[model samples]
Target: MPSSVPKTLTDWWCDASTEYAFLGFSYEVTACQSRDQLHREFADIRQNFNSRYVRLYGFCDRKGFYDDIVDAAWANTLGVHALIWFGFDGDDLWKGRRDVLLGALHSNPRAKFVTRVLQFGSEPLYDNVLPHDQLTQQVIKAKANLSDLHIPVTVSELAYGFQERGGAQDLLDAIDSINIHMLPFFAQDASTSAQAWPLVQRDLQWFIDHGNGKKMYFDENGWPSVTSSSVQPNSPNAVADVPNEQGYFNLLDQHCTDLKNVVAGGVGWFAHIYSDNQEPGYGIYDSKGRLKITLAPRTSC
Candidate 1:
């Protein structure tokens, strides 16, 4: 058993050692999802995959949606990486979403314990949801507003968005650390995860070169299991199927150490999704919540 206990949210994040990579799944909590479903899913995540973290993607529109999520996560002994989602419109939408998240956080005392990180927006820069400077200001303000909770606040964006977008450095300097989304499936490279490993490494190197030495986390990374006509792969060489999805995790298990060594603070990532019920093709489980691919046993070296 561990002797040290984490008092603050940042402490919880820091508790994971640089020598080992922590595993997690990105789950979207929809208003229509039942409480029983949430409990069952989180239980399956903990009991089956032995994952300790969950990166949540959703807004607080319906009452008790977030509370149920936190409760279920706490019951399963999983840490929550909560996201405050932003739409394509502007600050009004952003603020409304922010306020809703703040309300949820303030109302639930357990939120401080269960939530390890509070991500401000997902892909705000890539989608041009807000001006870079304005987004930076909001992040700074959020960090200040939630300082009492002691949770690390950051924004999620594509890995290259930080380098391509103007004023990214200012935003980077404002946040606690960098949260990047890297999906090799979208690249014009080889098909299978084995073929995509080189591109993954190249993306990691890009971060190492330009990330300003901040602690980096891949908030989203996984291969899609299937694709529709509208969701075709960028490369004809690429394929979307269950075998490739399994190969991605297999590669992660085999090269987990190299992934950790990409930065000084060590890197952590969450599998793109938990179930296809949330998003088509990206899930380890199918839409019916049945396991489609057997996850490789997590290995350190």
Candidate 2:
């Protein structure tokens, strides 16, 4: 077994592998970043980060970029979970982009080997980028094309969206899982790190019960370390005094532990990110590809 894998869900290893099958990293590549750098980073993740999958954020626009990612994942034996953008900028190029992305996924020789799940969109309702009906149709259309591959297809939403009965319900029935962004600290009724688990668990149960038997998967979950100005401005959803380094460790450790016991159930769980960025703060590694305080002593097999 790879040394980067964790031994148990609660092990919190500095140098241990886990029995868990699908711990993933949310990845975002900036324009300035090079393909060579990505190749090295992908290798590093496979060797040191204890992750078997990656959650890519958009319906990739550049063929070269998409191909580079495929090469990287293939070289490191990492699964790729591609997130189809849901008219984020507008509907102008959405259809065309979807066609291009689907074509690539269908034809890429390496895709069938490394691609695990193809999500329709990420947090569409939270951003109000696309109507629920439209997103549902997009998922259905993709499901039709990719059904032969037999990968799970779903749309991501915030936990709160599942609490009510309406468009969110329509979506829950149309897709495979109750995939959501469950950031308790970012919830409207936020709590501190030590007291956050119950609140998070309550939301998870709400999704499991109300989501009409669909499996639950956290599309994004992590506590931010910097509440002040650095990288991306702290999200508006974040509570005041979000968490320092130690607080981040405490919250993530507890949440992930509970996730293994109360949720997942052999399904996947993706951390919000692999590394800190100039825009987003929820990264285990710093911009220099170094482990941050929260991920000190990370080791390879």
Per model, state how many residue pairs clash: 0, 8
Superposed Cα deviation of residue 114, candidate 2 (Å): 1.1
Q: Which candidate's lDDT is highest?
A: 1
Give model 2's clash tally. Answer: 8
The superposed Cα distance between candidate 1 and the true structure at residue 19, in angstroms, equals: 8.1
Using TM-score as the measure, the top candidate is 1
TM value for model 1 = 0.90
Per-residue accuracy of model 1 over 192-294 as CA lDDT, tens digit each: 8877778888877776776677777777878888887656778888888888988887787787777777666477777888889887898888888689988
Q: Rate the local accuracy (lDDT) of all candidates.
A: 0.77, 0.62
RMSD to native for every prediction?
2.9, 6.8
Pairs clashing in candidate 2? 5-17, 5-18, 6-17, 6-18, 7-17, 7-18, 231-278, 232-279
TM, every model: 0.90, 0.79
User: Residue 196, candidate 1: how far off, in angstroms?
Assistant: 1.1
Which pairs, if any, clash in model 1? none
